[model samples]
Target chain A: MSERLAVLKTYKLFIGGTFPRSESGRVYQVTDAKGGWLANAPLASRKDARDAVVAARKAFGGWSGATAYLRGQVLYRVAEMLEGRRGQFTAEVAAGSGLSKAKAAAEVDAAIDRWVWYAGWSDKVAQVAGGANPVAGPYFNLSTPEPTGVVAVLAPRESAFLGLVSVLAPAIVTGNTVVLVASESAPLPALSLAEVLATSDVPGGVVNVLSGRAAELGAPLAAHRDVNAIDLSGADAELARELEVAAADNLKRVLRPRPGTSWTADPGPERMLALLETKTVWHPTGSLGASGSAY
Target chain B: MPSSPPQSASAASPLADVTASDAALRRFLHGLPGVDAVGLEARAAALGTRSIKTTAKAYAIDLAISMIDLTTLEGADTPGKVRALSAKGVTPDPTDRGTPPVAALCVYPDMVAEARAAVAGSGVKVASVATAFPAGRAALPVRLADTRDAVAAGADEIDMVIDRGAFLAGRYLEVYEQIRAVRDVCGTARLKVIFETGELSTYDNIRRVSWLAMLAGADFVKTSTGKVAVNATPANTLLLMEAVRDFRRETGRQVGVKPAGGIRTSKDAVKYLVMVNETLGADWLSARWFRFGASSLLNDLLMQRQKLRTGNYSGPDYVTVD
Candidate 1:
């Protein structure tokens, strides 16, 4: 008897916490290293990108307003789910990048660990960034860091699993909602990661993953006036330049890509800090007990 | 048991003569037409894609501002809260004095007097939500009294909710008579009937309810009470707009439409305006014909308006809390 046929999965874009085919009904065939057909990734249109930004914007209020401790717990839960699905990630990473099974497994483990690293940073980011300031006047001065609302990210194609986690973990850990364009060629792993995120208690629209050409999806997102910031760590020089210019329409906070930047290196707090805005508040400090300087 | 009563002799009420009997009303409604849900939703979504940008966007923002029925229907509402909402309504963007006052201030019956006093000389009409507001679970006598109290309290406009239980239970005549009775008690006040379409559960029912309200002498047919889980959606609003357009075509008299609840953005408000523009034409684009039943939506519009004028994005703190 012939061996049972493997049922191939159809990958859809994750937008607004639901899996929907592109409104344009366009999809591109994705293949493995040996050119074996893997899945059909949705060729998301400009409208799809705008829709994702809308979703991310809608989710910003709730996700950003959530208690820091709750966000930390939810991010940690993502790591737990990713660890449970380690073997699946390993297979996809291997099939997507033509890596050895052992190497792919290591990448998956590292990706899961990256989530854990950022999960712990969620609550600490506020304390590390916010503090009282000494002013000469009779006023209490303090500055607090706030999330810069909705962000659009172009995920690196080279390190689909690790690099995707590297960019996504920090943006969301700091309370900003994200609309990310997945690696154009090796999008299967990113699509699979969306499933993990959906089950990991990550709010829908909090992190939307679109699998398509980077420029097509990224252009609209960059130009979207509602999008507050953008990360171009994955784009090539030409596309990155174009996106950065388009992002200027709304004066979006941009993180430009540089050559030879390693995704495997330890990501610093800069990734989290880059997406936050400092808001300084001043309140008049009255004389303590009717006596000037009671102490 | 359907009652076949004698037809009244006046043309003042077109529905009064046609719907003389319960069976006649049922036949008239069910035979009005079947609603194509997909077609309605697709049309609404398509209209929403209109890019009212730059110069056109500025005009739409102001137009939307003037067309808003700045509303507060909270159970926890107080006199002070209503007064604040009224002040915000009269001058939405206090910093930008060029900003126009909203079309009206909508509140509950009890707060109608306070809202009226708050917006006294601003030319901002006071609208009161009556007939037990979000729910029409009260008796006919009580509901009529509720409408009378608001009208007596100087409410220029009365927003009354239809009894969904009666309409859903095939009590067409009862629903029609109730609206007529409320209209009678409203005296000179314009009657805006709330269908609470979410509870009705189907586009066909929304269409029927809209016509039922209009035929029974409603000055405007409102979408929701701003209290239902699902209120004033684009698809439902579009369906109601189409009904008013068709109603005018069939009967020479024109009616207005107000969609309340869940519309909390300048963009959503503009989309509804686009729907009104295309579906009902420019005639319904004014405050006289169309209005948004929203509170937070006004501030967002103000913020967007400020952005357009100043060329910088503004935050919530820049706008008033109301």
Candidate 2:
């Protein structure tokens, strides 16, 4: 009896809601942990990074302007989509990380729950992070945290699914659009997430995923005048410093990669708050007693 | 193109001799060589692919900035808005004094004096759109009055739209006489004839209008009124560049070409400068012989210029809100 051939999925970079091959038409061989042949992921170039920034900038206005309620629902919907694609992600994760099936399934489950965790914080983060200020003068002063435009993120290499979701969901939940550089080696899961995102309620360009060498893609994104901030969580010691220097050109808000992080641990509101800019408004009412008239 | 009896204007230094009659004008315009559409488009597209970078890019950005006629022609234009725009035109990047001021401040006739006042000592010429502008559908007297109004308000350059209805209908003499009449009223202020190329229909018509406006005494030939779906595309602009280059060759009369609408990026602006340099040579590279009739294009240029200077991307927040 003849054996049936297995259909393999083509991994492409997600930019502006569409999956496109790298502008340079270059692809790299992505392998499993034991050096087994996996798939060739799109080797995104600097131009791809530039295009991603453009898409993120274009999506910024709409996504950032959306009401917190709508943002929360949209993010929650991503969780739902990820939940349905559980089996596929589990297999990919297991293959890429050389993890047992049970452990990979647990990672997928944690990643799905992380989305729900960040989704609920969408409407409440601003309230918890900002409020009416107690000024010394007779005025109504209010401060609110606003998204800091387009954010560039480097998804963690070791913890592909959970770390990618952890960094991405937080930035977007606060109304910031993101251009994410997927992990260098285990990028299959991150690239596959683009499909789930496209199928989900998450608006295209709101979260663009690119799979390539972090060094090749990171420089342009870091130095890009349009990119407002960059989260260097996935970058190594040397690459992180290099990107931080380039990001300084535009004075981008840099979140340096920390030494060690457990993906399963509960992440506080720090990541979301890190990508936000506080806007303070002041309105004068003069001095008022019990009466409506000013004293 | 169909052959015609040699034009009376073709034989002389001055183009004024052709406006003697409508038949003579039509015969001359049709007599000009037909444009090879495929070749023109191919040449324009080929020129657009030139990779301009670094120092060349810096020079192009500055030259393009100096060639822009900073424009604001909305009905909702307030004095405050015009003043703010004029200030931005004068000092494009307030942080960097090295940034050159734009070539001119383009506004409506009513806002010309206001714009002029805002840009007095800055050497930024004030260009006013007259002759019923964008539409050019009014009576001759009203159109003539529109030119008179802008000129009287101290417009350094008067941008007048031709009656496309008359031009397309083959009323060549009528269109020629109207431009000549507006030219007479313009006096010291240079006359820039707007064809609104989107309405002109064909490359043949654009080429013919180019010759017609120049023969009628237009100091510059502008592409559009910025109110149409198609305006100042590279192919159309290249065609204008050729017309101006040939006009200078024929009559020793240099006419500037301004590709006005829909050019919103610095990269697109640089491609145009490359076209001008290649098509008309370095002589027409200055603001006197070339201009960009644009509003949002200034910010893009400024942002790009900042990027070139600092080696980083700039945002809309850094540049003025146009």
Q: How many clashes in each structure?
A: 0, 1
What do the candidate models score in CA lDDT, each in turn? Answer: 0.88, 0.91
Which candidate tops TM-score? 2
Error of 1 at B19 (Å): 8.8
Error of 1 at A275 (Å): 2.5
The CAPRI classification for model 1 reads as: incorrect
The candidate that achieves the highest lDDT relative to the unseen native structure: 2
TM-scores, chain B, all models: 0.95, 0.96
> What digit string (tens of lDDT, one per residue) describes model 1 on residues B1-322?
1111233356565455557888988877886667777887888899999878899999999999998999988889999999999999988888899998999999989999999899999999999999887788999999999999999999999999999999999999999999999999999999999999889988888878887888899999999888869989999998888888877866778999999999999899999988988989998889999989998999899988987886544555578776
Please give the lDDT score at residue B91 for candidate 1: 85
Model 2 agreement with the true structure over A175-200: per-residue lDDT tens digits: 99999999999999998999998988
